[model samples]
Target chain A: MATAEERSRLRDVPIPAIGGVRWLLGLVVPALLVVVWHLLVTTGVFAAHQLPEPLRVVGTLYAMGVAGDLWGHVAITLQRVFFGVLLGVAVGTGLGTLTGLSGLASDLLDPLLQSLKNIPSLAWVPLFLLWFGIGEGAKVLLIAVGAFFPVYLNLSTGIGEVSEDLLEVAEVYDLGRVEALRTVVFPAALPSLLVGIRGGVGLAWMFVVAAELIAASQGIGFLLSDGRVLARPDVIVGSILLFAFLGNLSDLAVKGVQRRVVDW
Target chain B: MADAPSEPTLSVRGLTKRYGDTVALADVDLAVRGGEFVAVVGPSGCGKSTLLRVLSGLEDRFEGRAAVDGDDVREGGSDAVGMVFQEPRLLPWTDVRGNVAVGLPADVDAADPDARARIDELIRIVGLGGFAERRPAELSGGMKQRVSLARGLAYDPSVLLLDEPFSALDRLTKHEQQDHLSDACAERGTTVVLVTHDVEEAAYLADRVVVLGDQPGRVETVVDVDADRPRERTDEDLLAVRARIVEALGV
Candidate 1:
């Protein structure tokens, strides 16, 4: 039994330690590079016109926030990511499980899906724009396309790696299909599923940027493009900074959930 | 000489398992009484684990009937039988308590006060009361196996099937575990079927050591361990049983 003090300590576990510090270390390098870039511009090592100073980027961000444009862009981008990832996770997991359970389905679909996954998500942008008409539909479809493969692959791998002994345990226990899945298969597969979600979260971010650059009218990607078209270096830099922050933040959030689910 | 009673709590007759063209256990027969500890020992790839799996009802793709308490083992019966694998195989995500409780009925509410109490007692019985909250990774191999043993016992099983459960442990730890296992089984009156390659371990623990031969396994001999319960490692009779097993295996 945990003492009252130990119980309190359990609650006090830092979300990052539970997730791991190495992933945070991965973010530090790019963040430091940005800081170094700002320092170079501030010290006149690079021309202000060519590379906007860090203060100018902050000023632009404040202006956008005050005018509520920042929230609008963030909201739109988030909505697209949410719908895409949700649809991808649902369909990918369902298909992945089916494939894992049935050898015939796995044999037919595995190679096809793997080959499609090899084609980068960005490569689909042009075709998606043509087929779905450069609208919300096209953007959501592209995000789903980006997120689907990693989640599906991970789910399938996880299901496949489940111990045969555990299956025997389930069989001996006389667990029905749903009960076996819930107690044995689900628990065994969760670590891998969470890993897939982490990979998918990053992919979703990548697609968000891709979607805005190629198809959407409003989003952080659009803001970045709009800044570039208007020759406003500060706005472009600010929007990029916002994407970096939110992308890192979202990755951290998924990682946090992964740690909780696979808490070892 | 007076004949012994032949009622078998577990009986296997002419059991045969083939994988494609390769036969595993062919025409093997054995009988085990309730509350008896039987250890099956053999050379490598002699299908000792295969025999245990079949008897546990995991390998139904075989010939002949394996009966438990006079009922034929026609299918995989996880609740009726409890198994400890070569590895602990605990769910890494579950804590010790949750892992042990996995063998219980899924809907049985493991959080119930009575179940929790039983789990707590079992943890102590298996010498893991202090490590209930630890995950599998946080545990040492012996500790993990202890948890596996606890989980198997938590099922309230009639027969405990162990597949080299202590094989992964160091020699010292293996002896410690053997002593504990013997004591625990005696107290609970749980029928145990242990599979091992170690002749000494089989001699030290089993009520009867069934020596098996390779190439489509068959029982060579059954060495009776008449050593008194709460047995000592240094006992002359136990060492003699070990000698008999080694001679039976021609090692």
Candidate 2:
């Protein structure tokens, strides 16, 4: 049989730059909102008491920054988020990996975890305040509770989603159970674990705000709550902006870690 | 034919595999001497892959005796065997070098000078020297399979098993892999057992080609190529052998 010996390129055309354009389009709505907000406040369409001018909010932020209270609130909130996320991820990941590896273990704990997940983190505020007495423990525990489910569930799903062939690869290499868990399974589940961490980070922020509102503390949430009691709408608006800024910062941090660690 | 002498490198006797009521392979006996390259070709559902899976000890539910160098194939034990499946099956997270290096015994000095040296040499031998840091996602199908071959040969096994390793590639890439594999096997005198649906590939690569018939697979015929190493496709004798194997498939 006659055969052609030349190597063939099986139509691997490069993807178009259309995807980048679509990404740029994602910025439109947020930009429009900021523009409209500034226009409405500047035009006096909304009372200053109801909606502070953007410049006034910025000025308030500047004053807070000069007094160093902005930094303090941000630092304390971040500290709570950091420790809470760490503790939650550690326990959740361990439980999740165990559940994923054994059906019986998953069956045993999935229901309890699922039930706890259903109760919003706010529901635990009063109980947490009663137990830990509105201190750092209550706040941190509340954030930990919020972060736990996402990390646990995502880690479990990630471990469960691991390819059977990949497991076979480890087996063919004669990797022991522990070695396989560490090298093969852990790496395989990392993308989902990062997704889980992202979810957990977002939830931790939500709980931090709720905890600050219910108790005596210093944080961006505390700043927002203090604005309400003092009837200073400018501080409330400033604190909300601060929360948005820090939330975005935490998300960026998570993304950075994902890139550095997962390399995906 | 009085015992055709010398110890067999691999032997299968009264091997039987069944998937519930459907019998895959039954009462089969096969043998290969050291350094012999045997190719098995069969129809779609003829249990060709099952046989390789059995040999690799991936599927052990089958009733059979498969011995490699006089040792029964056992699960989770390091034997002198390696396998390349149809897919490259590279770990998406690991780079080319790490993927190939995983084949070496885990206890081997991964951080040592000797292991690193051997890994570099194998990468070069597979013509993938510059692509070591590339992830599997960044590689072509052909390059990925080359990494797969490098992974299989990294361990220096007594016998290498391939299950349609290049069947997924384009025709030209398939031919290149066949040529590369043939040369590598000849250079090392490695015992090879390959299973494929393509009769032409079997004829070109095997010292002995075994044809298997339809379901509940059994050997129909065994043809000895007896052609010189590095045989060209244009050679009349090689073409004749290829024709005979294709005709035996009754296609």
Candidate 3:
């Protein structure tokens, strides 16, 4: 063992460099891609009408922004995705936990859920439109469908994977059934639950486009159809870029929460 | 009932455990007095840990009577027992304080200040005073085992069951932890039933070492140490006790 004096000598050692600004490295590829895109348009490889320049797309988005038309569409789409994810995750976690913890629930509910998950997101569009009509209900429910499966599947698998050793520890401590689940099983399954939430959020974005493409006056997905109808290639490309940016932003947020929850 | 003269803190009579065709333990019998430290030592497949699992109520299908604090092991008697498995088996998402709190008896409100004080005291006894905020992944193997020990002691059970808790440690850390455990249990006067494969560890820590034989484990011999506290590892008498335990295994 080190003496007090010797231990004190080690106290002044410098800390390692922090990972500040390392995230900027991720922007490099996108920046290069944008420059190449600009060159492809400028060098006349593609006609201006065939493919709009990067600046023109940005200019179109800026005009929509200045006219205050962009905010309403962005707000409505954000709201739909938000509520859809909320409803989906809530229902998914409930079913996932039930099926994960009980054999009876898994047996009764799993087959139907597994079958339902195989249906494509767009396939649900017409059925949902007919059922709930062309209102926000059908659109939000469609996105919710996309969000539900990943959380359900991931959480169910995560809870099932809890180690028997820890379960034995819980038994030894006399944690009882519910107490053991709260202390041992839930925390152990949290990482997988978070993983499912990230996937669910990604799917929600994909489904929102499908939801809006059929019937809606607002949302970024409608902008794609609207731009195509008007024969303005710039609007269509800008809408796609908006989807990518928002999808990545939400994913990053979920990842940040995952880091904090699974820090151990 | 035939031989037990007084009510023992822990008692096992005709304890037989089986998994299909294989018998892990058969007709094993043992009794321990209050505050006594008993260690069951045997070769790897001798079913010593099976005995511990039964005592701790992890295995409920045993064929005989095993009681802790006078209650049958299968019927809530295990509430009086605290167990430490070979692996730390801690929840990775929690810090030391929260993990230790998991062992608190059902009646104790974990949010209570008194409960927190007791948890902190157990942590201190296990020599982890300043590490209450540290997570399990931050600790070394020895430190993690120390946390496990603290957790086992948290509920203040009348009987503590250990399944080779220190068998994973290095030689030096194992010795230090054994000494720490010895001191803590001595102070609390907690009755202990430890199962380990290490004969020397049994000799060092147990008041009486129970050697179990291999096929369908049964008591081979019981060697009494009767040594003084804070015993010297190299003492002549300690070496004599170690020899007796090793010989009882017939290896």
Give me the candidate number with maximum DockQ. 3
Candidate 2 structure quality by residue, lDDT tens digits, B1-251: 45544558888888889989988887778898878999999899888888887887787687878888777776432267778877888888888888888777767865678988888777887778899999999999888888888888776677889888887678887887788888888888789999988877888889999888888888888888978877877667778888888888888
Model 1 residue A15 CA deviation (Å) reads: 22
- Candidate 2 at residue B32, lDDT? 87
Candidate 3 deviant stretches above 4 angstroms: A1-21, B1-4, B168-180, B186-189, B228-236
Candidate 3 per-residue lDDT over residues B1-251, each given as its tens digit: 65444989899999999988889999999999989999999888889888988998888798989998689988988888999988898888899999999889988989999999999998887778999999999998888887898889887788998888887678987888889888878888899999888878888898999999988888999999988878888777779999998888988
Candidate with the larger TM-score of 1 and 3 = 3
Which residue pairs overlap in candidate 1's backbone?
A: A172-B77, A172-B78, A173-B78
Superposition TM-score, candidate 1 onto the true structure? 0.80
Tell me, by TM-score, which candidate is best.
3
lDDT of 2 by residue, A1-264 (tens): 122322233223323545557777778997888789889988889888888877888899999899987899889998999889998888888998889888999999988998989998889999998899978887888898888889999999899989888787676666669878877889998888888999999999999999988785698899999999888889998988888888889999999999998874
Candidate 1 residues B9-87, lDDT tens each? 7788999988898888988999888789999998888888888778777776888878787677774333467777777
Candidate 3 lDDT over residue span A1-264, tens digit each:
477777776564322332476677789999999999999999999888778999999999999999999989889999999999998998899999999999899999999999999999999999998999999988888888899999999999889889999998888888989999999899888998899999999999999999987799999999989988998899999999999989999999999999988898
Question: Residue A224, candidate 2: how far off, in angstroms?
Answer: 1.7
Task: Give model 1's docking category.
Answer: acceptable
If the candidates were sorted by their TM-score against the true structure, best first, what order would they fall in? 3, 2, 1
Q: Sum up the clashes in candidate 1.
A: 3
Pick out the ten consecutive residues of candidate 3 chain A with the lowest summed lDDT. Answer: A10-19
Candidate 2 positional error at A204, Å: 0.6
